[model samples]
Target: DQQVKQNSPSLSVQEGRISILNCDYTNSMFDYFLWYKKYPAEGPTFLISISSIKDKNEDGRFTVFLNKSAKHLSLHIVPSQPGDSAVYFCAASNQGGKLIFGQGTELSVKP
Candidate 1:
């Protein structure tokens, strides 16, 4: 089954603190991974991505790590900001074009 699971429905962190989000998948064929950050009434924007070939990927304050063997992945946000408050979706696709996404993790940055 092509299922990406975000165990947590939501997360809250103080501003400037680190926020961690977890995700798991059942599909072994999933080789390419991506994280998308979305605000309300908008489409998901690509945050970071890692291929099955690489274990980690990072951009600015956002980082994503993948463990192929464990079928797990996580996203870490450093120095979380109030602007960062939004839904984060972890997506995976073996074919590289189409993606399967988790329900979502809503991140709230408290001031």
Candidate 2:
């Protein structure tokens, strides 16, 4: 079964606008959530994260909000830039660093 799901395969947005991406999970046992930004053929870089105890986390231009009751989470990017164009992966781990990722949401920031 797929524990994590990113429904959108891609999203395109203007450089100065807001971009939002969504994700869902099936397992409630997951206690930690993370978002990774990746470039073509490259390893994912950590963006932001939140513990099960928190509802929202933000870092610079990126913000992640978690709704534990609905088993859902979302990522928001404000004033998106061309450099923000990349694949975004949402991951979760129960204990250690081992993470399960979504297929990915490709964001294209048009300048």
Candidate 3:
């Protein structure tokens, strides 16, 4: 059973625009969060992350916000670039240290 879900299968944004990707989880036990970016034929690479204790975390042009009460999270990419066009996955883990992943949301950054 899928504990995590990404409602949107894809998103398109112009270069220099902001891209927002959303995810929701049914498992309240999820405490650690992570976002991974993947290029075609490449393995997913860690992008950004947040813990349940933190409401938000930011790095460079990327930001992730967690809503523990809502069991929701979102990733924001500022100035979305064509290079950023790829599949993005949302992952969560609890104290047991097993990761649960949501279906990836494909992001297209048009030049």
Q: State each model's C-alpha RMSD to the native.
A: 1.2, 0.8, 0.7
Candidate 1: residue 22 lDDT (0-100): 95
Residue 109, candidate 1: Cα error in Å is 0.5
Task: Report the lDDT tens digits of candidate 3 across residue range 78-105.
Answer: 9899999999999999878788999999
lDDT of 1 by residue, 1-111 (tens): 539999899999999999999999999999899899999999889889999998888899998999988999999999899999999999999794999999999999999
Best by lDDT: 3
Provide the TM-score for each candidate, comma-separated. 0.95, 0.96, 0.97
**1-111 in candidate 2: lDDT tens per residue?**
889999999999998999998999998989999999999999999999999999999889889999999999999999899999999999998887789998899999999
Error of 1 at 1 (Å): 5.7
Clashing pairs in 3: none
Count: clashes, candidate 3: 0
In candidate 2, which residue pairs get closer than 3 Å at backbone N, Cα or C atoms, i.e. clash?
A: none
For candidate 3, the 10 contiguous residues with the lowest summed lDDT are 92-101
